[model samples]
Target chain A: MNIHIIGGGAVGLFFAAQWCEKHAVTLWTRTEQQAEMISRGGIRVLENHMENIYPVNSKKIESLYVEGDLVVVAVKQYHMKEVLPLLQNAAAQSVLFLQNGMSHLDFLEQVPHPHLYAASVEHGLAKIDGRTIQVNGRNKTNIGSLRSGTAGIIDQLQTGSFRFDWNENSYHMLIEKMAANAIINPLTALLKVKNGEIAENARFRAIAKDLSREFASVFSYKTAEDTFQSVLSICTKTADNESSMLKDMKAGNLTEIDAIVGVLLKTAEKNHRSVPAFQLLYNMIKGKENTPEFMSK
Target chain B: MNIHIIGGGAVGLFFAAQWCEKHAVTLWTRTEQQAEMISRGGIRVLENHMENIYPVNSKKIESLYVEGDLVVVAVKQYHMKEVLPLLQNAAAQSVLFLQNGMSHLDFLEQVPHPHLYAASVEHGLAKIDGRTIQVNGRNKTNIGSLRSGTAGIIDQLQTGSFRFDWNENSYHMLIEKMAANAIINPLTALLKVKNGEIAENARFRAIAKDLSREFASVFSYKTAEDTFQSVLSICTKTADNESSMLKDMKAGNLTEIDAIVGVLLKTAEKNHRSVPAFQLLYNMIKGKENTPEFMSK
Candidate 1:
């Protein structure tokens, strides 16, 4: 498969490095500096358990050709608007959004693709440096059709060392992931705590539960007690790994709070459900997201 | 008039040191250390424009007889419950609450006294060290009756050093202060920004405005525009001064968010009004408030 990755962050690099071993993989980075670094040093995969440097083709977003078997969009949620324009020109057979939040659907609508896959990365991969990924926690990745279902993309993706399943009920999975992000991401970011710290604190646990119940109601998904427990488990597993939102906070970068929490809040408003805790957290994180110091560029 | 000051932080000392020049005064501190420091060095009055220190007898709360005409409670909101017992034992005719937030009303029903005055201070004063106050702003003080019925207490407090107004509609004043604190205190604490920084940022301004609107809906306080602007102005005036909440955050002391944001949220829920911004802010701050580093032994 001629695979193209549309973001050079940890997730994009993780897939590109793994897939390039068997396929022709092209990685898209936002900046020329990042592309240059990857061109010279290749992609470095720093697993939590082991250290290995893998070489992969890296190119700027503008340099990529429009034809590819698969396209992976792994950029931050806020960048989707700009990225969508690029994807509109891409002649990819399948496009998968392996990013945080729900607003990606809006961007996906703008692109000309029949097969759209929306998935969440359960694996914990963080960008340590340019094109360097630190894989922590035994992470599972799930992908499924958003609209006009794609079948072979999962098999094509599985050709690499990536583990993914064809999720028939991916909407529920996406909603659950959004709920977890709504409760966990902004909480950890604002509190300046790790995911495990949130798990450790009963008050935070209660907050997560409150937020989860609200999400379950608005999205019409079963936000079971086990879902919340799973969230805490993720926090425990990724104890030292700063959540994406927390990493954004530390870097003073824009967070995916709007897509994650804002989407949940908007959904709640539409459903006539009150999500006080989620709304509050979304606004707080949004404040950080909107700050110039936190902006991507 | 004899005035007894309790919880000898900046407000208590500000009142005791100034009022003692004209009236017989006793400043009651919680700790023996503060009592000893004040008893030996006296209470210092550091105005934004002027500077002076006055010696007043500082006693522990247990030793306070409260035989004065007016008693001022200047401790933290969390300390209110602990100090309520002491107030019940006091013999004061009038009790004045000079702390931030609306939690003083918690003591409203417990008051055996005839005159109860609630007040808020904008004078940016912080005890940088023992017996030292850095007054960054020459802000006015507001005093009013919780009920429309108490005028005598307001009359007595009018004799204090700063500007004082007898507000028959003090509920709005309390709400205004609460709203302002909800926005300013947490933003300053979380962003590690000074007051002026909040005003400069569009994001913080949005947060302030959103929170104010939510607070107004719940509390029914009306202003021409967002009342949080007034808070930002106050921060600008006290630009170099650390906000009380920021100071608490720095010292790892408990914040009065429960008294400020939490109480407002509860009131909103009771009134069937939604306060999404405040709820998230309350949860975020509440989580921080729960940290062991925040609570004093």
Candidate 2:
């Protein structure tokens, strides 16, 4: 099966390096410079203390023909709108989306596709340069069908190191991941600490619990205790990894606050639930986004 | 009038420098080394683009006899407990407590004195060293009696630059300042920004307004809008200054989180009101306090 990944970020390169070994995969990047760099040097992926270069096909988004068996949307949630039109026009049999937060659910519902799948990427991937990405940690990708069964492309994409688990309900899985992200990402960014600090630090743990309780109250999927434990477990699992939001803040780049915390806050407002902690976290991240350094960029 | 200032922090040194010009003042500090340095070199105060050396007597806490017309406790709120016994056994006619937050109000009630007053220091003061302090900004100190009238020492302590105003209700004044500190200090420290950012940034302003509303609901002394405006004005007045809590975090010292946010959160809990924002802020500050670097210190 042929696969087309829409994004040149860490996640995009991560999946391309894995799937290129088994299936024909093409990576689409926004800038021609990034596309040229990846096409010339190949995708250098650092995994398990070993460096491997994969000869993956790379193309600029403007000059790409997205005809493939599966089209994977791997960009940050903020850039999803810009790539929506292209994804809609793609001649792909199945569409797989790998974005954080539940805000994209509404947009994904509007896209017309015969087969649609949503995924939660549990791995920690960092972009070292234009074409080089370091795999800090590896975890299973939970993918489930949104509209129809994802049987056609799921098996073809799963590899030994890049594991993929089939989730029965994609919405529930995505919501669970969103709950974890909503609690972990902003707090880590605001506190300027690693993921494990949230669990290790008693004060941060209390906050994580309170935020989880607020989230569980809004979603009604799991109990507050369950949500809190899940978040704590994730923090423990990725203790050494710096959260994506923290990385973005350190790099002076825009974060996924809108997609992650913004969506949860909007839902809480709609449900008449007060989430003061989440609101404050959201505002703080937004404040950082509007800082002079970030504004100039 | 003889004035004995307890605590050689920025506030202690600031008041000692001003009062020493008119009254016989002695400053007491925990460390004998610091006391010796201050006794030998005097207290160097930098204010209004000029440096002034005030001849002030200094003594270690152990050798100090708290006999004076007025005893001003200007230590951090956390250290107030350790000095409470000294203040209670003091031979002073009047006692003035210049610590931050309402947590000290209960402790102040236990100390017996002819004139018991609580003053909110509005100036921005930073301790440059053991014997030197820079006055970042000048503002009036609002002094009010917690018990009887403060007649003997109020006028003697008021200076041209360090002005003092008598407030009818010292409890109200302290609560007002506590509300502002509860909102400003933790937010600035967690966001890693200056005081002005709280008022200047739109998102931070919203969070500030929300937190102010929460505080107003618990206190009921002022309306939400009034509390928000008061905090906004303070942020504007001290725009370039880093909050004391922020300074403590940077210096890897313990913050007065218990005195400021802790008092508010306890009040909220007792009244059965949820203060998620304040709780989150409290936890984040505590998290920083628990860091290995701060723990070692």
Candidate 3:
């Protein structure tokens, strides 16, 4: 099987390294420098106190599209617009998206791809520079079918080190994952605490309970308590990790707050529910994104 | 007229220094050390390029209550419980309460004093030590009669450097002031920003407007928009000052969270309205107060 992975970020590099073992994988990067570096040195992955590099073909995004059996679009939701055209033009048999938040679900309706799928990655991976990567805890990458007749593709892609779990209801899966993201991300960012504090810190936990209950009332099919419990579980599992949003804030980078909280705010509005916590967190994160120093002493 | 100013904080010391120049002022301190310090060196007040120290009578809390004509109670709402018995047994003709929140309004009924008044200080003040104080922007102290026969007391206190503005509707004036405190204090403390940033920062301003509007709808006599406008005006006026709550958080001291937001939360509950932003800010501040390092990275 031949696969094309888009974007040179952590998720992109992780999938490229994992799938290249059994599949003919070509990593597509935004810059020729990254493509050349990866092509020359291979994708270096550090795990279990071991350093290993996987050799894979690579090309810049602007280069001629290499027709592959599968194309994995692993980019931030905001970058979806730029890469959507590339995915549309690619002659891949199936296109799978691995982006956080449900924002991309809306734009997927416009895509002409025959086999479409979306996934929430549980395994936290970090891409160091163009080629180096570190994979934490071998958590399952939950994948769900957005378009029919794509169950076969899900089966074919299951044979890899990157664990893939199939969910019949993709929307619910994304919502649950998003509830975790929306609750944990902005809070850890704004409060500047590690992920565990969301659950361990009594005061933060109280607010998290309110936010989770409010969020589930408007968005979740699961009961508010269930959703809140799941959020606490995630915090405990990733206790030591600084949330991506917090890191983004420290580096003064634009966060995926729009994709996470912005989508929640819009859904709450459509549902005619007043979610003040969601609204406040959304506005606070957006403000922090524009000026990191604004919220600081 | 003889005046007794209870409490030795910045506000108490400022009032003692200002009023002692005109009226015979006696300051009461919780600690005998503070009383001895003030009694020996006088209350030093820094204002308008002038360092003025006024000699005044001072005593510890357990000392016999002086038979002054007017007693200005300048303690925090939390300490009101401890000092209520003191105020009740005092020989003063009128007892005036100058606290930040509306919490004391409930217990003011228990005070057996002949006349009662409550005030909200507009002037920003800081106690340098047991005796030294800094007074910023000599804004008028708005006083209102909490009980009958207090109009005369407001008039009598008007002779001092601490300008007193008498309002017929004192509850309304306190609510307006509490609204400002509710909107400004927790935000500055949580976000670690100056008072001005609440109005100047676009993201913070958006949250502030929403919070203000939500708060006014449940508590204020003024419309939500009108209340929010007043909050903005306040942010502009005291842009440089560090809110007392923020200072308390920095100093790792217990804040008046229960007095300010706790009272508001109870009001919201009684009104059967949900205030998520208020609840969240309250919990976060309480969490911060308990562990100042909890919210920080």
Candidate 4:
């Protein structure tokens, strides 16, 4: 199967390197320099203290013809709107979205593709350079169709190092990941602590509980205790990992606060439920993003 | 007038230095070393970029006879419970309670003194050393009786460098100050930023607005905007000052989170109002306080 990944970020490069091992894969990067570097040097993958470079086709996003069996949209959610139109005109047989947060659910509904898949990538990936990617942790990627059954491209992509699971309910999978991001991302960013610190610190644990209750209310979870435990477990599992939001803050880059927490706040307002914790976290992340240092970048 | 100031911390030492100028004053500190230092070298006051050392009498808290005309309780709210029994047995005609939160209101009601006054110290003060204090800013100290008219000690305290205002409604003044502390203290401590950063930063300002609204709801303020403006002004006025709570966090000491935000949360619960912001901030501050580093200290 011919696969085209629509982002050159860590997620995009990681998947392209894995899928290119067994299938025809091409990476589309926004910058010509990154595309030229990857095309000449190949995509580098560092896992378990070992480095392997995979030869794959690379092209600038603007020059892409978008004719492939599967096109995976792996860009940040904040960049989704600008990239959506390009995907709409693509002649791909199926499109897969691997973005975080539920904000993209609205955009998914409007897609004209016959076979549309939304995925939650749980794998930990970091971009070492323009063409090199580091695999911090290998985890399963949850994928489900928005309007149809599992796409045939999944079987081709789910070979070797690329692992994919078919989620029965795409919304449920997306919401679950969204809930975790909503709680973990902004908090880890705001506290300037690792993911595990939220659960390790008692006071921060209490906050995690309160935030879980608020999420339970908006998501209609059966009990807040269950939600809190799920969040705590995630914190323990990713204890040492600095959250993507925190990394964004440190890099002086804009975070996906609007897509994650902003969506929840709007839902809370519509439900006439008060979620002050989410409100504060959202404002703080937004404030940090708006600071002079971040704005200049 | 003979004034007895309890607690040899910054506020205690500050008032001791100011009151000793016109009135016979005695400072009671928990340690004999601090007391001996003050007794030997006198209390130094740095105001207006000038230093003045005033000769003052100092005694250890254990040796306190409590036989002064006016007993000024200038300790932290956390220390109030342990020292309250001593103040109850004191031979002072009247007692003045200067505390940060509304939690001390209950303790003030239990005092046997005929004239009971609770004053909010608005002045910015920092302890240079055990025997020296620097006045960051001189603001009016609002003093009023919890149940009666203006206490006679107000007249004595109103003179000299110590400015005091007769607050007709002590509860009102206390609530106003508590609201500001509720917003400023935990945020500054948790963010590890100065007081002015709260107002200068847009994101933190949004948080200040939300916190102010929650406080206004519990305290029955006319509007959240007015309360938010008042809190912002306090941030501006003391821009360079590190809040006592923030200072406590930096020093790895326990803060008065319970006295300040704890009271507001309890009040909100009693009123059947939700305050997630305060609950989170309280938990964060309490969590930082309960850390191993802070606990060992």
lDDT of 2 by residue, A1-297 (tens): 899999999899999999998999999999989999999999999988999999988999974455788899999998988888888888878888999997777797667778888999999888999999998889989999988865545677788878999988888999999999999998887777789989998878999999989999899989999999999999999998888887888787889998999998898899999888898888888888735353222
Better of 3 and 4 by DockQ: 3
Ranking of predictions according to lDDT: 2, 4, 3, 1
Q: Please write out the lDDT profile of model 2 over residues B1-297, one tens digit for every residue.
A: 898999999999989998887899999999999999999999999988899998889988964455788888888889887898878788888888888898888786688888888899899989999999999899889999887875555567787777888888788899999999999998887776789989999989999999998999899989999999999999999999989987888777889899999999999999998888888888888878734343222
TM per candidate: 0.84, 0.96, 0.91, 0.90
Task: Give lDDT tens digits, candidate 4, residues A184-220.
Answer: 9988876667899999988788888999999989888
Error of 2 at B287 (Å): 0.7
Judged by TM-score relative to the true structure, which candidate is superior, 1 or 2?
2
Tens-digit lDDT track of model 1 for A205-295: 7777766667767876474576778788778888877788888877867788888888877888888987765655665566666454532
lDDT of 1 by residue, B1-297 (tens): 887788877778777776777778888887889889988987666664667878788787785555767777888888988888888878977878876888778778987877777887877777766666766665677777764346555455555456676667677778777877877888777666677767766666666666666766776656626575677677577777667787777677788888888787778888998665566566666677635443221
True contacts kept of 2: 0.76
Summed backbone clashes in each candidate are 3, 0, 0, 0
Clashing pairs in 3: none
TM-score of chain A of each: 0.92, 0.96, 0.94, 0.94
Tell me each candidate's i-RMS in Å: 7.5, 6.6, 3.1, 7.4
Model 2 TM-score (2 dp): 0.96
Clashing pairs in 4: none
Would you list the C-alpha lDDT of every candidate in the order shown?
0.75, 0.87, 0.84, 0.84
Give one digit per residue, the lDDT tens place, for model 4 in B46-113.
98899999899998887455677888999899999888887877887778888888888878667888
lDDT of 3 by residue, A1-297 (tens): 888999898888888888887889988899999999999999999888889989989899974356877788887888888888777788877778888899998888777768888889887666667889887656788888888635556566766566677888999999999999999999988888888988998889998899888888788588889888999999998887777788788778889999998988888889998889888888777766855664344
Strongest candidate by DockQ: 2
Docking class of 1: acceptable
